[model samples]
Target chain A: MSHIHIDIRKKTYPARDGSGEHLAIRDLHFELAAGEFVCLVGPSGCGKTTLLNLIAGLDRHFEGSIRADEGAATLRIAYMFQNPRLLPWRTVRENIQLALPKGEGREWVDHLLEVMGLTASQNQYPQRLSLGMSRRVALVRAFAIRPSLLLMDEPLVSVDAPTARRIRQLLVRVWQERPHSVLFVTHDLREAIALADRLIFLSAPPTALLHEVTVDIPRGEREDETAVEAFRRRLIGEHQQIRDLL
Target chain B: MRSLLYHPISSFLLFLAFWQGLAVILASPALPAPQAVFQVLYQEIRSGNLPFHLGVTLARLAVSFVLAMSLGTAIGIFLGRHEKLDRFFDHWLVIFLNVPALVTVILCYVWFGLGEIAAIAAVVVNKLPNVVVILREGARTLDRDLLEMAEAYRFGRLKTLLHVIWPQLFPFLIGAARTGIALIWKIILLVELLGRSNGMGYQLHLFFQMFDVAGILAYTIAFVAVIQSIEALVLKPLDVRAKRWRR
Candidate 1:
């Protein structure tokens, strides 16, 4: 099945403080296919989040259109944010339950709990979990409902190095089997290269898509670090070039 | 031993001893010592009128406090969910917050014709706005990402409130309740003084009319003791419960 075409010909947000205006994104035309992992790479202040918000329908001011061809108008969309954003009041399992359609069975929640390695901590709330564990819970919360499109906004940035790699691996496995499209946003170029099939690089502030690069890597848990190293170097190279310009 | 234990009783005993020593050095029998006060308290208790009147006063105080807390929390939650509603009520809230409890109680008596309803109304009005302001600020200061996450997963408004909004609001509610509970007891006494019969404040007024300082002290002690019990038993549990969401 084909994923949606986001022909966001232009997107603009009016400046709240009357500082002229804010151009979050402009003329962004992209088509994502089913089972494709697309990453948006940008500087820290770039509008990757705004573009993700547009796709999520959390905001609707974009000039163009995004049409999902595969699902009905009510199909669920999952999102993982930079902060994990789990409710501190809710237990780890309950946060996943929030994603499910009402009256859905507990079995699906149980499965995700097991897969996310949160079974032991299922009764604990978000504040009790480490940053990496909370991020795992956040990932499971997004994937629990089997969304039509999963949107991730720098989901692993808060975790330590070893845990970030593990989470990156977990995300890839879920992406490989997601049965939907993923629009991943990150400022980390290496993260984009590691998980994305195609990477869209967004420049600073009033962000514009500078370039899109395609990555070809097979799936598996082979612990070879060379490709990851090479991808990191390439993204770092791009990062330096973008940094100089911005 | 647990978090709720109060340490001021021993300090209070020491303070009383120091007062007694000062009175002894000054050789003044006019200032009753702590021992004399305790003797008076024991004689009043043995006569059984103390417990009866104390229970009546405590019951009135409890009714007033419970009414204030439940109604205050409801008003607080309502103000929290509606921004324009909060703005419209802002001046009204400030008006009530700044009004002296004695003046508010007298006004309630005049307006509502000096009844139990007037007394409860006074307590409720006195306590409500602080809770509203506290929870309004709590709701306003809510983490933006948690809200976005709720929408992202498509949680319904009811679920969002119960799971997301309420937990964040609870700590503030507890804080408001702590302060409100304190304010509540004092306001209830004033309400009882201005309108009601058979309460600690009414007895205090009676003692004042007779110029009976010991009777006045006894009634004040009874009311303070009741408020202290509620604090140690009730509000402390709520405080712990609210903070439980953090870890």
Candidate 2:
């Protein structure tokens, strides 16, 4: 069954100058299965972040409907942006705590910090942390609230390769421990294949769904670099459209 | 070498030495020696006049500062967020900012009749525009990304304000406060001198008429000392605490 349904009929940006309205997304529709990991893969500037924003309910100007099967009002959603977007003045621990609903305990926060190997730097400000550490804190913040759905927008895009690998591993481990539905947006097809149970590809702006591919490999074998690359090669070789787009 | 020379104590002592030297050269009552001024300052304090007037002036400063800060911050945030309202009142703010403090003081006393309310109102009017401008700039530059983060995380109005909005506005608020305190106190003194019957300014006025330069110097020194202590004991500590998160 679908955990969330997104039917974006149209979304547009009004002209700032005297130009004209620019269509961003049109005739896009998709559903995320319960506890499924879905990666939205697209070319650069394909309104992927805009789509995430629309689903997260940050922008209400679009003509569309995004509903969670659990009931939209009661649904808890956590979003991890492209940047850390942490409150620089707050400590890592406090930044995570800001995500918790009222009267919730700090034990979950402590547990996540320990799991992410950020317990030692919990009290330190974001400025003191490396980019990798800040990303982990952002992840911890997203998970602290234990949202029913998590939306991530290229969260590991700019990190160094080693750090990205570590973060990706930690992310998979955390998601495995507490299986929440996630709609992860990334431009990297290889990264998508490595992490996603299902991959949703998109066309360029006025972006729409181009194709969807289910990763056939089990979660255990998908982590192996050789296996992930081989699967990516096979998938691209078979699909002429995805090969062209990627 | 520069650090030692510019140490606050050493710099202060150098200032005193220069004053003493100038006093000896001029030998005028207007520029009394530091020791002579301190003697007068002691007598004034012992007589209880200095403390009483200082307290009265400080009380006025406190009232006006609080009023201006709260009112200005609210209005600043409002204008900064609403481009239309800001544009409408932009000229008004400029006019108020450019109006002389002396004119405001005279107008308030003439309209409100030489009362405490008039004195404080004058000070508030003189300082309010500055606070509003600083905080408006702060409100304008608020981070849209962080705001979106707050919204996505379900940070309702109050939490968004306390966590996301307030921290971003803090440096601006601090800037407003520091400049506000300095500007308000000076305006308060002018208001007191022009209208009120009691305050450091009134005493200074009396000293001016009698050519009691020593008394003037003494009162000035005592007031300066109090302001310095406040900066050291209150504002500096607050600043340090706020900046603890930064490297």
Candidate 3:
């Protein structure tokens, strides 16, 4: 069964200077299956973040409906934005604890902090943390609730290469253990190939899905950067639209 | 501990020496020696007069400070969140902010008939606008990204306010509070001097009538000591705790 179904016929923003409306997304319809890892690859300004916002219920003015298997109201959703977005005044542990539902235990928070190798720094504030460490705290916060559907908007972008790789590995490890449907948005094709079971390509604004590619390699083998790069090159060569859009 | 205490203590001694030297040079009744002021302060304390007046003034300050802060914070947040309400009330805030404390006190007494309610209301009227202005700026500058995070995580209203909104507003609240306490106590004194039968302000007025400079100095010293202690004991600790999360 699909974990969540998103059918946004149109989404638009009014021009600030009294001009006509600017179309953001048109005819973007897709369903995320339970436990499936899907990466949305799109060009910059393609409204990927806006689409995620729609699904996360942050921006509810878009057209059409998003239905989950458990009904929209009951389905738990967690979002990780591009920036760390951790509360600076809150300690790392307190930040994660804030995300948990009432009556939930702190054990899950401790376990996630341990998985992220942030157990020692959990009492420290976000301002004292390096960007990589803060991002790890943000990831721990996202997983603290064990949401049924997780939406990430280029969460690993702009990090140093080694830290980004380490974060991706931690992300995959946690996702494997928790087993949830994830809609990951990224501009990096190689990163998506390494992380996603299926890659959905999107065009520039008034964004619509252009193509879908399935990574045939086994999950364990995807850890090899050379193999992921080779697969990305082959996929780009095969799909002229993917090459043009990217 | 020594480093922290040494400078302030030495500075205070330096101030006393200067005052003593100036008193000896001038040798006027209007400018009494620090020792003479201390003697008067001791006498008032011994007779129970200083404590009673100080307690009464402090009670008025507490009531007015709390009322202004709570009311101003709620109104400020409401106005900040709603552009239309802010626009509507902007002129009123400006008028109240600029009106003199003395005018408000006299008006409250004239209108409400020289009662405790009038004195406190006068102080609240004078201090509320400042708190509102401070907290309005705070509410306006709240982080949008964190608010979105709260919404995505389903924090709900109360949780969002406590964990997310409150921390962001804390610095502003502190700003409002520090200024509020300072402003409220001064206005309370003015209100008491204008109409009330008792309090440090009324006693100061009585001393002024008799040209009892030593008595005025003693009362002023006592009040300043109390205010400084509050800042040292209550506000400084709060500020340190708030900034503990910062690098």
lDDT of 1: 0.77
* Candidate 1 segments whose C-alpha is farther than 4 A from its true place: A16-20, A71-74, A101-105, A203-213, A220-246, B1-9, B15-52, B74-92, B245-247
RMSD per candidate (Å) reads: 4.2, 1.5, 1.9
Candidate 2, CAPRI quality class derived from DockQ:
high
| Top-scoring candidate (DockQ) | 3
lDDT of 2 by residue, A13-81 (tens): 986785999999999999988889999999999999999999999999998899888689877889999
- Expressed as tens digits, the lDDT of each residue in B1-247 for candidate 3 is 7786578788899899999999999999999999999999999999999999999999998888889999999998988889899999999999999999989998999999999999999999999999899889989988999999999998999999999889888889888888777788788778888898899999999999999999999999999899888888988789778877787
Error of 3 at A41 (Å): 0.7
- Minimum summed lDDT over a 10-residue window in model 3 chain B is located at B1-10
Q: Which residue ranges in model 3 land beyond 4 Å of their true spot?
A: B1-6
lDDT of 1 by residue, B193-220 (tens): 7788867677777877877666666666
Candidates 1 and 3 compared by lDDT, better number: 3
Q: Give the TM-score of candidate 3.
A: 0.96
Each candidate structure's TM-score, on Cα atoms with residue i matched to residue i, is 0.84, 0.97, 0.96
- Each predicted model: what fraction of the native A–B Cα contacts (within 8 Å) does it retain? 0.97, 0.90, 1.00
Model 1 interface CAPRI class: medium
Poorest lDDT segment (10 consecutive residues) of candidate 1 chain B:
B1-10
| B71-115: candidate 2 lDDT, tens digit per residue | 999999999999999999999999999999999999999999999
